[model samples]
Target chain A: MADSDELFSGLYQAVLSGDEDGAARLATRALDSGHSALETIERALIPGIREAGDLWEEGEYFLPELVTAAQAMKAAMAVLQPVLGAEAKSLSLGRVVIATVEGDIHDIGKSLVATMLSANGFEVIDEGAGVPVSRLIERAREVDADLVCASALLTTTMPRQRELVNAVRSAGLRAKVMVGGAPVTRGWAEQIGADGHADNALSAVNVARTLVGHRAAG
Target chain B: MEGLRPKLEMFTGEEADRVIDHALGVLSKVGFLVENGDAKALLREAGIEEKGARFHPPEAAVRQALGTVPARVCLFDRDGALAADLGGDRVHFDPGSAAIHILDPGTKRRRPPVTRDLCHLAWVTQACKNIAAQSTALVPSDVPESFGDRFRLHVALLNSKKPIVTGTFGTDAFDVMKRMLVAVRGSEKALTERPLAVFDCCPTAPLTWSELTCQALVDCARSAIPAELVSMPMGGATAPVTLREMVVQHCAESLSGVLIHQLACPGAPLIWGGSPAAFDMRHGTTPMGAIETMMVDLGNAQVGKRLGLPTHAYMGMSDAKVLDWQNGMESGIGAILAALSGINMISGPGMLDFETTQSLEKLVLDDQVCGMALRLSRGISLDSAGEAVELIRELTVLGNFLGHRHTRASFRREQFLPSRLVDRATHDDWEASGGADARDRAEGEVRGILARGNPAPPADDLGRDLDELIRAEARRLGIEALPEV
Candidate 1:
């Protein structure tokens, strides 16, 4: 059997190269070799994705590379998720339920934010686009979500973001609300009683981490 | 006396008809979900049938509405002086309104704007010669949320002499706002005779008009006040994915609004205006600066012009978060395009961050951009061609036009002399003058204008009445004092 150092590095390399199959294999191997699921994720998968994020930030990597690296990280998590189970919930930065508000069909920004949160070790439940405020709150309650991220692409639909905030607060859920979109501003977010607002996907992640009191992963 | 004015047409005659045809079809088939009772009754009078909470105006209704709409809208200053003519090839500019944050010049941080910020905005706008009107640009946080709409207009009226481009947040604010305007004009009849503000009434994208905004539209039309139809269609999101289709959606929405307004009061003045953006798929943001967004705006305006109506567009703004190169490039391009298209009352200067924030410095800088754009739209003049040939012949051997009488007489008319914010100095001279960037220079300009004090405050009695109105409203909201300007 390979040493612990070799197993972690192999997993890291697989994730960095966006080799989903290799990432799953190495994760399984690490788990079988007696390393904890948390350790496998922390020591390899998180670092790999963090490096990819860094590379993207520094202009060394583009979007496609970043997305693929995230895919590989997700593959490794798929293996760790069942084994880790309830404990894996603690390993996540936070649980986020994200969606594009109802009556607005825009989804690219919300999807990007969801993918980014997932890549950064946050448990993300993406509701896709045109999700009603009630469903969003219901899902947040179901998951005991740490944050509810709502995106609205139109001035008409922005009222729904406010509705989401009101619904969450009325239900007495602990989840914080975050809103974003083309027409959304920090002021609008604050005015609507949302906990936070981000203008772009990267900022959304940062804002999410800040709201949940989580330090940057890796 | 007519110089060859430059023009930009985004649609051919047939293309415009195609857009209008589709828009009419959408109104007849897809329909708009209008929630206002008065608007519904008006549409019902115009042969529009309400089907399942949506009003579908037939083509004849749309055509009849279009025919009744005044081809021009005139705005007056607070002093009842004619300020702007929204008609044929006359372009005016106002700062984008309703931004919630102000980029504080001292800290360079964006914070919730207060009364002082709004006053400062008015002062600088008054001093900007190229900016033709004032906007209720900042939503002051100190006031109650419901009072924001009229409070902004009140502050603007007291601080600046220019006509305002403003809107209402609550349906109740409309009458209070109209009363304030009446106070300024000395009576309701005078206010109606010379409208001092153009209220923006936005229709939600994908054929929806909210109750609040629709009520504002009906109120404006019935009151004989001009309403600017701000149809905002974020392409591929609230609107169709295709650019042309986005323009079609914008027209359909605005056309439905026109039918409601004209049916309420025929011959009512309205500007077929919009704030549509091209959806940037990669970023999931509506980029106002994108060329495609400009195309949608121009195309929308082209349709308005084709129908013999005045037009407005939310152009000359940037989505950049700061006063940077991106801001300059985007704003400059939008200004030129809007001007070349001959859009009347272009409504976006001093806007940044997706129209969420306003900067005093950017306002001063965009004033120069607007000046240059207005000059560009004037095009080159063959009117001066014969005189130029004579000057050249007279100075053939001297090679010195600088000292010539013709050069001295015509230089101001021939060239657009930009402000100091535009750096045309020698590199060494620029270095000697502090080596400041555009933002730094703009900061200085804003400071200089503010230091000059309010250029056009209202008369003392009028100002007092306006203040009392706002104070009473604040008192009603359980507020004791307003922030000092």
Candidate 2:
């Protein structure tokens, strides 16, 4: 059996390269080698995803690379989750329910934000595009979500973000509502009573961390 | 080409001489406090002595410094192309700099800008036809406060091909910012040969030079970068209440900057520029859009030109919070007057709310305003009068000159056709387009320009070097990750 450093590097390289099969294989190897699932995740998978996030922010990695890395992280998580059981819950930064507001079918921005949030250690529940505000709030309540993010790409559909914020508040949910998209601005976020706003996917993770009261990574 | 150009002169030649004389007198009698030790040492080398904590330069020292200063300063784009030529009667424009907040296009309210906002601004500036250079327009709140100065310049170099008009905050900021420019320009020598930026070094009001600003001026001169002296003298507040005294004070401060820069490195490029405002006693604010402020700017530039040096002014900006009639009135009048006065570089196209906020929508709208001002400065060309008479003789009989070849050949040159931002359509046509207001139209234009993306992104190797340098600096400052551009 490989030593711990070599085994962890194998998993990290697997995730960084977006090789899902290799990630699952290395994750199992680490666990079979007497390493706890939490140690495997903390020492291997999380560092891999954070490096990918850094590369994406540095402009060296594109969207396709980032999306695939997220997939590899998910595959590794699938292999490790059962052993960790409820301890898996503590590994995530927070639970976030993300969606595009109603009447807006633009999914590229929302999907990118979801992938970024997930890679940055948030347990992202992506409800996809054109989701109604009521269903979004309902999903947040179902997951006991810490944050709910809504994206509206058009000027006409932007008011839906405001609706999501109001619904989340009126429902007496503890989830912080965050807004974004093509036409959304920090001013719009303030006007609609959102907890925070991010202009792009990379910053979305930081905003989410801040909203959930986590110490944001430097 | 030889036709007389329309011009606006705030002072006659004799009056300009009188202003310079008064400025020299002020420098000699009431010396400016030199905050930086090196700057004071340079002045001492030039036969100026510090008395009572001030450096009182004699007339000969000022003259010697003025004699070596270059009359023109040229700026190059990121790809080493000539972007703007700042010389006699040549008008170039860039947006205002260092705004803490940006006016959101969607909500029309002001908020702190981020990296993406600054990158979008660089793309917009790259696409503008009349705005020739980019400014470090917004201070991104996401970056560490110490990194803001170089980070703004880094973003501009990455996203735009135009030369940047930028500045530094602290004494230590100039070196790293210069390194970024050097990387883009291939080497320090290459950057010096074709300067990619002009650093705005501002002296505080009331004849005091802060240590940081004085150091920036020294660094800019030594690096062969153009140092734009921005002496902001507010009438009735920091300066004398009267306009003439305000103008004289502006001159004295600017001349002191010139002396310091030239004493550091003789024949270095420097621009005689200012953002002086007429203080409003009623509100205790400096109104940049006031006519009195514009006069102070023009008077200062007039002195700069009389000294045979390049000139700059902060004009064509509004004090209005939103795009409205007041915005239009102030922006238009300032642009026209600045152009007519032949200010070499105008630096306030997108500023609003007393220069604290920048609106990208207003920036696109102001591009058209600058276009019209440039057209007006061309005046009437009498080069083809005989041809015009012949066409008139032929068209008088037919009563239909629309199809005339002469009209066809001259219409494009004779007219300045504005973009969709200027509403020239019929009422029905306007309504057909959803009756969008100027703000909406401006927003659409900004979207279109940004959609086109960066026309002149840096090359891959250059881009990588820039990223590595910025990342290393950010890490040194304890910023593990910077927001993507």
Candidate 3:
């Protein structure tokens, strides 16, 4: 039998080099070697990609490089989807359906959160740009999503953030919600009844995780 | 019907003229203080005499030099369409200036930015259609050399087919930029009449310019390039605590710029431009999102419009690091206001971190907003906005307007339909389509733009000359020429 440890290291290196095929191949080999899929992903891929994050912060890397590495890691994760089905539950980060609210249609900030969450082990259900409050709530329920990340860039459209929160309540899901964008602040987040707030993408992940934990504890 | 154009009298008038005249008197007599050595050297080359602490550009010499400036210019595009008309009512957008650092990979911290960064930034700007003109993100010093002049010319080569808005460091670069402009418009006279570039000459916050800016006023004027007298006054920081006082300082500095510039080159196109804001006491940062920032943006343009001078202001920029709701609100409102106000050449897109960092996402988003704002200036036509009553009638109580002739005609061009920015579908439709949200769509959009390299060819052979001029300059400054990424 092949050594799972060595196979896992290969998965890490493939992702770091942005080789999607290599990463998926290595990920499958490790899975076949009877290595726990969750263990391989958590110990190998997560740490390796986060190191890329560190490299980015250190100025030794830029966005193109980070994005490439993230892409490869996501490719590997996608390959593991069918095989790891029920076993994936324990490793899964609560899914958050993220979108920008209607009447305002900028989405890059919201995408960053999706990336961050996906990298951090979330099964992010992205309702690509310009989601109406009604759709956002319905999608969150359909995905069994624990959180909804609503981003609105325009002041004219900021009210839609609040409308999403209200729509969630009216739907009786009251799923933990978070709001962000250029005009959004902690004050506005509270005003709109979001369960949590993230000032940026990095914070959004931690906040999303914490919100889910809080709801589960309740 | 009263047009949507902003009223100049409400913001500036005879009172502005008097205040500006007083400020000019202060400038002629007291002059300005200088601390930076290179700025000092440039001033001396431009004919200012340094007297210990001050560089006194004789008011007459300043006026004499100002006489050489040209007053009007028009930039043509690759298809010969009008791209931007400087020294006029057109409000064109450009990138941010003088970012000292970018997020570094090796250290996870910011360090001194180098020319390679500038080259990358230039390329990035080139790829972006929203960038009507350009600015250097930083000077090249990756290996430590005198690349200031070469850097300016290089950026002109890399970014603009439209007339450039740039500046120089020393007398040596004056001709280099001149050569570069010649390369763009195709003649020395074209540089003057067609107006390929506008040299930025800034006044120190509050009331004065160090000797270099004053000397630059004269030099830029004599050079026959339009000079943008940018005032960066902040309420309660480097300026008086009041917004009015900040405006006064801005007016004063601009008049002082005009006084010296007119002296050097009279009737040259001098724009009143600025990056004014209120100082946030809590954070010790200038709040570019503050109401005062908008006031300064609107107010200074008012001052220039009153003088019948071309205007520019550092507006339409969000301090937001990413394209979030706050980013949209700050940038969308600010940019829309800038267009409606009738300020010519508003320069702030792709600006972030209080004018220190640049984000690709923010830049594209800003452009989308810029598209919407520019359209705002055209005003909603009565013919097209569709008779509201008629539209209601057309929509017979139960019938949908989805495939209506009016809707079909107007949907594609009249409305600003966003890609990856907005959603316009039923809930079920949104859910079925990857169920992805705006952010997801934006992320995909950003990935797409960067992946498909958008390269515009150099406007002319002058672009090649500009490149050579800049490379020669970098070598002379002891810096390696930036390599194309």
Q: What is the TM-score of chain A alone in each candidate?
A: 0.89, 0.94, 0.86
With candidate 2 superimposed using the best TM-score fit, by how many Å does residue B149's alpha carbon deviate from the native? 0.4
Q: How close is candidate 3 to the true structure, as a TM-score?
A: 0.59
Candidate 2 clash pair list = none
Better of 1 and 3 by lDDT: 1
- Residues A1-218 of candidate 1 have per-residue lDDT tens digits of 35898889888988777777899999998889888898899899988988877876654654445666777788898998888978875777899999999998887667777877898878899998899988998899999999999999999999999889899999999999999888887778889889998765666778899999976433
Name model 2 segments beyond 4 Å from true. A1-218
Off by over 4 Å in 3: A1-218, B1-3, B6-73, B77-81, B87-89, B103-131, B138-145, B169-171, B321-325, B384-404, B423-443, B459-464, B480-482
Name the 10 consecutive residues with the lowest summed lDDT in model 3 chain B: B1-10
Instruction: Write down the TM-score of every candidate.
Output: 0.68, 0.69, 0.59
Question: Which of the predicted structures, 1 or 3, would earn the higher TM-score when compared with the native?
Answer: 1
The 10-residue segment of model 2 chain A with minimum total lDDT is A56-65
Report, for every candidate in turn, its global Cα lDDT versus the true structure.
Answer: 0.87, 0.88, 0.67
Tens digit of per-residue lDDT, candidate 2, span B108-171? 8999999999999998888789999999989999988788998999999999999999999767
